[model samples]
Target: MWKYLKIVLALCGFILNTMILHTNPINDVTNLISIIEKLRPLHKKLGKPGPHDWLAHHHEPGQTFQEYYKSNPMTPRGKRCVIYIQPLGEFTQVQRRIVVLTSDFMSRFYNLQVKVQKDIPLSVIPNKARRRHPEWGVEQILTSYILNDILKPKLPADAAAYIALTISDLWPGRGWNFVFGQASLRERVGVWSIYRNGNPAESENSFRLCLLRTIKTAVHEIGHMFSMSHCVKYECCMCGSNHREEADRRPLWFCPECMAKVCWATCSDPVDRYQILAEFCEEHGFNNEKEFYKKSIAKLES
Candidate 1:
């Protein structure tokens, strides 16, 4: 009798952990499913990768909604609803403007409060963590230090994710030449650089491109901080990239699976998110992005 009772109790525990853990209430899940279905047509189904694309170079199994839920991904709630951005170096006037715009966009993207902390000088980076590229000669800072030592320790009590944005280039450790950015998902900390985002002062087009690239990387890294992994199922913003060309090939929007993760985590309304994004893109003359968002809204409403 004791052995039979123990087996029954174990089965009940397993069922609850798999089905109920990390999921919203039954009604909320139903509503999210309905929203995802309506917004489906606005997003293209990913077909095949090009010769030099991320999927061609890397093998990722991709994370589905079920996998994400089982992972117990972090969500914004109560006091932990703020996203914080820490500036680590000097910025040109245009670069500064890009930072300002990105902060504003982030707030709307995740439906959370975004706070830009006071600027911290690059001088704070120790000499050991600073290096010059062997051939390119461009100076680079260590990304791990910023993530582990700086942002993690300084993370705010109310922060959902703490991100550091710097104008300087970054390299993760000793293996690579340089990296665009790096983030630790479990730690809820990350860092990115605008150095390779293109020179915003070059031309009007350059400025716009720089801004778009910066926003893409910023949000992508933040997505990781939410425990979202590289998107293998679609050509979404959550897709991993090995190089600039590959990254640029992906759309600035989330695919259905990845979109569900974000909306679930943030408790955001998909229609409202699309409307705000459309408005922001339109105001910034991001016509292509703006049109996509508008179409997403249309699909949801229709």
Candidate 2:
């Protein structure tokens, strides 16, 4: 049964990859394996994890978390994260994707790095960013074209950085927050895209907010690289947002519990992650989300 279940997880991962145009190098994965093991021993002793155990992780389930654990499929450390981002040029729609990425990272406390690579023309990619951020006109988002293509991976100079690339049409998501990364902490990470925001003859502030959201989205997705989850304390930027309005509702911070979870997830210190995020946010002026959003709209319109 345990072996069969492992097959299920692997198959599921493969199917998901095909659907999203995403890939997991360790087609033979690990994170899920290790987690199941560590928890299984105690799970049986304590009845096992809640019904929600298989809830968001896979979108599908097979045998059981405990069953897999007893079987001992893999180790504690592995990169189970794998994200596929569609293009949105550089506006609100793009921001939505990033938000989804960030929220997912916080929820799991996993390191999922996101990056951008030019792909199809913004015009070709649809534009949901405009619908949400009407303030930004369409002209700005309807940037020049490349083709109906995937983003080319661009590795950063720093050894600490890596890259992944892809491009999808507008309105990308069937889940709350998902990401792409190697199961092993040792692997370098990255993701990027060129998605369209909307289709407006004129540009506006709403368009700019759309752009701001895209930046936020990238930041959120990249946060996954560190293995962090949604903050329970204060409104977490990692918290899921279904609409543009909700996107503005959360603050960017990992709750205390989530912070602890990330530490365990990445085998790193939580404070260290927090410090990195805080500093990055401050540097990019992500602290002024509202202002930035508003500015995005204004900028695009001009």
- Candidate 1, residues 59-167, lDDT tens digits: the string is 8888986688668787665457899999999877888899999998898888899999989999999998899999999999999889987898899998989999999
Evaluated against the true structure, the overall lDDT of model 2 is 0.37
Candidate 2, 1-302: lDDT as tens digits: 99999999978876674434212322212443443233322111212223433223333222232332234232123234433343333444645444454434333324444333343344543553223324433222111121112222332332232333233322223332222111112233434333333332135554444444544444444444443333222344444444445554444433333333333333443334444554444444456643433332233234
Query: What are the Cα lDDT values of the candidates?
Result: 0.84, 0.37
With candidate 2 superimposed using the best TM-score fit, by how many Å does residue 47's alpha carbon deviate from the native? Answer: 32
Best model per lDDT: 1
- Candidate 2 error regions (>4 Å): 1-169, 172-212, 219-234, 287-302
Q: How many backbone clashes does candidate 2 have?
A: 70
Error of 2 at 124 (Å): 8.9
Best by TM-score: 1
